[model samples]
Target: MSTSSVVTAPWRLLWRLGLRSSPLALAAPLVRTRPDPDLAPVALRAAGADVAAEPAALESAFPHATDRIVVLVPDTDEDESAWLRHLDQVGGTYASRLAALLDWTPVNVRVSPGEGTAVEVATTLQALVDGWPVPVRRIALIGHGRGGLVLRAACALRHQTPDAWHELVSDVVLLGTPHLAVPAGRTMVPLSRRVDEELAGIVTDDVVDVSAQPLPHARYALITPHTRLQQSRLGGLLGDVLWWRHRLPMRPRKARSLFPSATLHHVPTHEIGLVNHPDVHQAMLAWLA
Candidate 1:
């Protein structure tokens, strides 16, 4: 073996062994800092609702649109305000820049309590869709990270309920979503994977082989970044290996199979912060068109 290969082989072996026997494999729930209760109210307001308001009460805040209704689902552990701010930075406020880009009313949905399993988020989304005051002709869902999984679950729920929301959904956009499984590590994975087996269970149940059971009548798009999870030299190498095995084209390929007509976009970056990238936003706008 070459000198470099000889030196790295032992480390690779150790990593493989660690992953197999690590406590993380047992799927223990990650301990997270308690989110500020105040943030919840802020999130609700950003979504155009009062903290105490019912889902139905928030509907009037969104203008009725015959062209389409666009809903943005933020990443796990993110507040709606953060996403709204991102939207404003990328385009403008929903009524101005986004409205021009999409030619539709854009809405943001806040996942209550701020953090949870995909199923919990999906339940909230279903309620949000059910409570819409205006009829939906065409709907588009844009989700980031675990939010994408929540969108898929919401679609599944719609299938079960036979709602206008499902029938109206024209497309779903997933941004850096880990459809199969994320890289198996604590420091390298996102908050969604750090959650208990709930996240894993949902992904495995819904998308382990989604190509076999794709959502009906809606186009899908998977967008990912070519990013590194680690910065340290040794860690970066390991991260690259894990990323190549887990991230890369794996999730997107699965998505394409699931939705044979699905489109895939790769952003040149080192993280999942695509919301701030104008090119990514433009790509999504193009996809919507």
Candidate 2:
């Protein structure tokens, strides 16, 4: 054998062996580790993500407690019961539980228009609070996504509407609501584009500058949930891009800036899903307690 061949033989063999042993080189990217069954999901809401879900009507919706009521706002692509879905599957609803704690009943606001107008929704809430035939004692509000904006609009009208909303709303909890401007959605899908348009319309018409404006007689809880990275279809290359694109503009600082009096709780997991999570329930209850 030549001198050079002999000298490189051992090195070549080691390199080949190393390739076979390395997980990244040849092995399939399977056997991904998953969390334990007991693992709880966590999330945070950023200010730039706007939800475009349609809200519901008042009388036909959830049961109401005239004396005491807890109102929950559903985020994008969700309804009034969005917060209750997880808890309902487990046992009861977080809203009802919270209402019970404060001797209140859960009430969700749904606008008359099927498509949902922000002004109408806010007006309805104000009317309810102001027009209650009986003497109402306690009222609490929990809003997810765009619901937060609507509630803020409702509360902003405390003086204009003659509703004791400012005085009645004892506690307010916001789940990842976008109280400020959301991004112009880059989603290429046609349906998603329509939703984005609707959201933009709401931002233009419904959004109020509640910056540094705290609701009167209300305790604020602003919870932010970090979103999980979705598995990418193009081997995660595109997936990572899309994930950051949606989440990058989301800033907890925006939420904090909007509600200075709010007690902020951030969960850097998958930004809250389309539905509510139980761990969030515990967190809100603990805060109130």
Best by lDDT: 1
What is the overall TM-score of model 1 with all chains considered together?
0.60
lDDT of 2: 0.48
CA lDDT of each candidate? 0.51, 0.48
Candidate 1 local accuracy as lDDT? 0.51
lDDT (10s digit) by residue, model 1, range 1-289: 0111112243442242233455453323233235556654223333445432344555545545344668777765665565644554455543344577667777676553232444454554455566656545778887776667666655665346666456777878877665553223343554333332232222343333353444678888876543222222232333322222244544431213333456766555422245655666666666677
Model 2 lDDT per residue over 1-289, tens place: 0111112232332242233455354222111234233421111111222222213223323235357767666653344545555554556567666766645556555322123344555555555655454556777788776567666655665455444456767788887664344343443433323332232222322234544266756898776532211222222321222222243445531112456678766543222232455566677667555
| Residue 60 displacement (Å), model 2 | 11
TM-score of each: 0.60, 0.54
Stretches of candidate 1 off by over 4 Å are 1-56, 63-67, 84-96, 112-130, 158-162, 182-212, 228-261, 270-272
